[model samples]
Target: MVNVFEQEDIMNTLKHMHKWFNDGLINPDAATTDQGPKWCVVSSGQGFPGAEVSWATGRGKDVYAEPFAGPLYSTTSILGSVNAISASSKYKTEALKYLEFVNTDETMRNMFAYGIEGTDFSKNEDGTITRTENCYSPATYSQATYFTLYPVAPNAADQWDKVEEWNETAESSVLLGFNFDRTNVETEIANCSLIMSRYDKELYTGTRDPEEAVPALYEELEKAGLETIREEYQKQIDEWLASK
Candidate 1:
């Protein structure tokens, strides 16, 4: 909740980025060009271990991924994929039961995730799955527990076990499960977002000097009521801590 945008460490990092950009170490079109596996020599994104297999296979090139830092478990990560029942739903109980069934029943979970078993995919004798042509491949993680879904070939059968171990060892954030309600600061949040959109991309991508750009951005955010938003966040966080 603290406004760390103007902190020394952040400023230093931006300064380094600016230097890199000027020295031609960073892509010249970094601020404007679209970047992805197919577009850039290097790109950053979130993915679990062993995800490179799929990325490599899809791109027909060797793709490797390494974590820059250890995993940190936080509210954002925990809720990255979630199922929510509508507050005004008439069948809230049935919805809850259905969600429970999806998470608990392997057959139901796989069907919901990968489609009809024989038609979409076939189970291997060694326990992996082979997806057929025109297979229904939705975002599997969002559907149910990853452990319940059978592993596709080239990905280890114990990949989910490794993920579980990774989760177990992840450092838990103090703010885990602390939801920040932005209802009171909606106007300020909107205004600040607009202000940030004008300057953040250029500054972060090293298209602008942080020394001059950061101050300008900060001033505009303050004018857009950034302090009010910060204060509201701090208040909620403090109350949440007290409850804990």
Candidate 2:
């Protein structure tokens, strides 16, 4: 654990990192740079379907990876986004049918997931798909279930299988089932957000020193009702725990 206030520890680490970055030794957006520095990092989703397509289509440079961190356990696996046909829509039934079709029908799902196949992507002899040179659509299939989408290369054919395996074995948080309803605490949250946004934009980006800035940030947050916000969340969490 790091003592955030300690100048020689966390603060020094930030300063050194900022200095290296200023000296051009460190890359901030290391994942998505088109410059193709000797080394970079990207998330799993970005690594496979993202950079692969960019490199293939001449839009971005190629880079290789050696694991910097690996096999980490997920603390939560809850779906943060929900997709559904609106109940008030006139075509609600049709919409539901379409939703069902997309989830259950692989062909339809692939059509939606990857766009016009041969134009947007080409099927390889090995069964993995590659993005076409003129494929304008971005692969953002997170809106739907991952399993339903077609497996695009340079992702291994078994990538989805690996994802499922990892999820099955991953750790769960103690607050797994707890969902905080902020209806009663919205004002406090908004005020706290204002304070956080004002400071975090600079403080986290190494533009502001942690020593002078973090304390002031906290002070502003407290004045903005962060304590009240925390208390309300804790109250809800306690009720959830007791119910569990």
Best by lDDT: 1
* TM per candidate: 0.83, 0.67
Question: Candidate 2's residue-wise lDDT over 1-244, tens digit each?
Answer: 1224445666776676566556766556533345764433432332322435444434344644443333333223354335766778999888888777777887777777777877888888876788776575654654466776656777677666666675566556667677789998898889877777676545544556666777887788778877777788889888988998
Candidate 1 stretches greater than 4 Å from native: 25-27, 32-38
Collision count of model 1: 0
Best by TM-score: 1
Clashing pairs in 1: none
Error of 2 at 200 (Å): 1.4
